[model samples]
Target: MLVTRQKTLRRFWYPVMPVGKVEAGPQPFTLLGEKIVVWKAADGDVVALADRCPHRSAALSLGWVDGNAIVCPYHGWSYDGSGTCVRVPQRPESNGLKGRVVPSFPCTVRYGHVWVALGEPLAPIPDWPEEDDASYRRIDQFYETWRCAGLRLMENSFDNAHIHFVHRDTFGDIDNPDPPQPAIERLPYGFVARSDVPVYNNELQKKNLRDDSAVTIRHITARWYMPFLRRLHIRYPSGLDHIIVTAATPIADDRCQVVQFCFRSDSEADAPARDIIAFDRRVTEEDRAVLESTDFDVPLDMNSGVERHMPSDQPGLLMRRMLIELLAAHGESEHTRHDAGRATQEQKSSS
Candidate 1:
């Protein structure tokens, strides 16, 4: 069985770029394997449309933004924010072409990122409560591309067991390789995984510590939403609260772009954003080094027994199952079936 990529993953909103990046100029982006151009309208709202010009198939991104419309460089054809071709310089009398339009996507700007839906969004864009909370200060926002599949990065973000081994140099301790079993709470949209974990604070975190005493226990809670959104909350015993909201947008089947926002309730007035971003970059880089080298581009099918699961893998397991369910609900489960069949065949051949 095979499934079209778009059908498998079109119902979710993807963060394509930072809101500031798309100004009065056209910026080209790819989402769900489709080329799109985003620009700011004269009213300052964001707009997204197919990147190609109808006249010459030239990339609209190659052209410039004129007020609220995007002008094609090849033929001086102009398109408005709604994807309507409003002008054709060569044919001034072409009134019949007013109805000619290019493809347009639903775009929304939130959390400092521009989000576009390739298809009708099944739900509203996911949100983090801490983003607007008065107690929590938004500190850092960073973006990076990973060479692994979006699911891989998402699973890594949800995996607590990997910290001891994969991040030993940064924040993990090799001697303590075991983590407590996480409590999983299933929700209508997704699930929440909660556990108490010991954290080894880096120098930057140490500086922000409210208490200088050597306390390592922190309450960790991770909330995962349907396709690829996650919010991780870390509460210290010293009344310091930290949150990380991560959205992994699929760039291709084997690649993704991740936007991360870090927030803290303590020391917001003094904590340096660069230090926090640097720490996150280091940890994500460590994960990227391993994820990019993995053999599988896509996540393993949870129902298939090819991959082993432990108590600590509950969150990732639930995530994979939920993703499979979403794809099936969207009538795109052929890919999942194909993957499972292949895995079964590989196992049988090996045995």
Candidate 2:
């Protein structure tokens, strides 16, 4: 059941952290509600595995790395990067040492972060900021924990309505009653929205401080891979030369972890990368507060069927509905019956 619930996050490789974060030791973390341990072998390969030792169920991360193998702290049992049990202390004659292996996940490092696919590979992790594009520069990348499902958070980020209201102080004006209505247009792979008005009152918007008249627009692209893995592209101040924000959100149900990478022109050497990170974190915290306030205790079925949506909510609503249809068709195949249980629980509660 847990495996099925994490299908989307597992099937596709997800960037967990910058490559520098996980060194030569076992780093324990959780994703999609499953406890996992990540470690870099001496050979520079990254490995992610279920954290528990197969023998005494001790945390594998509590052990030490012996060469390319992880030595369990409890009984000296060791497992290799492929999760194969390579050694067992004082058990040379035992058959358990032969093919016994631990569950393992595949991992790779790209764009400066470590990525792990929770399950068998569904597809190669797509490259971003496409390699040949000299106009792009790696601005920032990091992980954020939200006490809300990743789906809701992603939708909220792409949501056009919240910009005019929830972000009135930073991204919108205080008394600007006549905010320019956003225009959303569908893109080949996802969607885009544009506005030629200044919606933010931030440092970037102050007339003497920066170019406040720079038309602020946001272009977004969304692709869902189910069990809650989403790829989103957000480009701000449309018509700029590839100033793009790409992110992947893996939903761990009520809590989601997002890995975002921001890009700017490579020639723009004067851009302050840390400042951009701080700015994004500020907006993200605001979004986190709003998403976490939803009635999560309510069952999924009730939340699914008993909600009212405004006209401004169309884009998010459509995306969610499309996900629902996709899951209904592939849910069982993906072994995501637990989501159905949650949905049914909500259905009954709503009744």
Candidate 3:
């Protein structure tokens, strides 16, 4: 399903960009069909609001930041963090534009990403424990837009059977096409699946382990949070732990911005960050090429038989079921449509 077509999906916080990049001026981002800007106040508080300027419909991102307000480029109007119009260049300083405001969203920083919710959030931002732990080094790997839906990304991450075919160039091998079945467990936040996948000990593994073993088993514990957050923890024979966290933030109906980061138990001396990133980048590229060539959206209603299924598709099947349940519980009502219509009218009138 198209996330923007549903009101409930907009209520979840989605990462837009890395927090370190939110500097200088308002940076424009597309989150759940909304053109929003992320900037920092003089006091170092992160501010997010609609990218539109109320006076003349200019993009707020094109303007510069002055103290805690973002100045509009078209008419010199400025708005504060709360989206209240604080200054109007065309009018007298004494007269405040009381009713002039821009729509705003809840913004915060977590896991080195700027998360913004287009509407009232249904839950807090999902936590990644290694971010606060001192023993592990967290590396922000990649932040790029992919031509695939968030569900497809999430589904692919949890699918293990594809390793033999989709990733043959990287780490897949026929020596052990499949190792073990995943043990699925439900959680309050989402779900967890534990399995051991046999894989060829590629260059990445050889460097990390410092051994030239032909093959190895990846004891993986996969976790999925509501919406599109994933964590895959893999344990190697040498007691090396590799934890990868991926977030797929919906940008539009057929596109998603993916933020991938990882945590390693070894120090920089043992495993270089560059090597890890390079290997994962290639893996992701393989998935991207195939995903882009296929369907863009995931079929949420599994009963319609929109696509074929197999026994190995259990992870993806459960993913669809969970999202379907979310829709059944919080589908858009008449009141939501009315509010959206009113918001559209207000925007048109302002323009």
Best by lDDT: 3
Candidate 3 Cα RMSD after full superposition onto the native fold (Å) = 5.0
Give each model a TM-score.
0.90, 0.78, 0.91
TM-score quality measure for candidate 3: 0.91
lDDT of 1 by residue, 43-119 (tens): 88799999999887999998998887889989899998888888888788883166747999899998888999888
Better of 1 and 2 by TM-score: 1
Per-residue lDDT of model 2, residues 122-147, tens digit only: 56665554545776667555576766
lDDT of 3 at 318: 90
Q: What is the C-alpha RMSD of each candidate to the true structure, in Å?
A: 4.5, 5.1, 5.0
> Which ten contiguous residues of candidate 2 have the minimum total lDDT?
295-304
Q: What is the Å distance of residue 105 in model 2 from its true position?
A: 1.6
| lDDT assessment of candidate 1 | 0.78
Compose the digit string of candidate 3's lDDT tens values, residues 1-351. 767787888888888899987785689999878899999888888989999987778899999888988888888888888988888777866354676389988999888888999889887887677788888999899999998888888988988877877888888864556636699998765799999887886778688767688888889999998788888999888888899989899888789999999999888899789988888898999999888776765677667566898777898889878877777788642223345578899999999
Q: What is the model-wide C-alpha lDDT for candidate 2?
A: 0.62
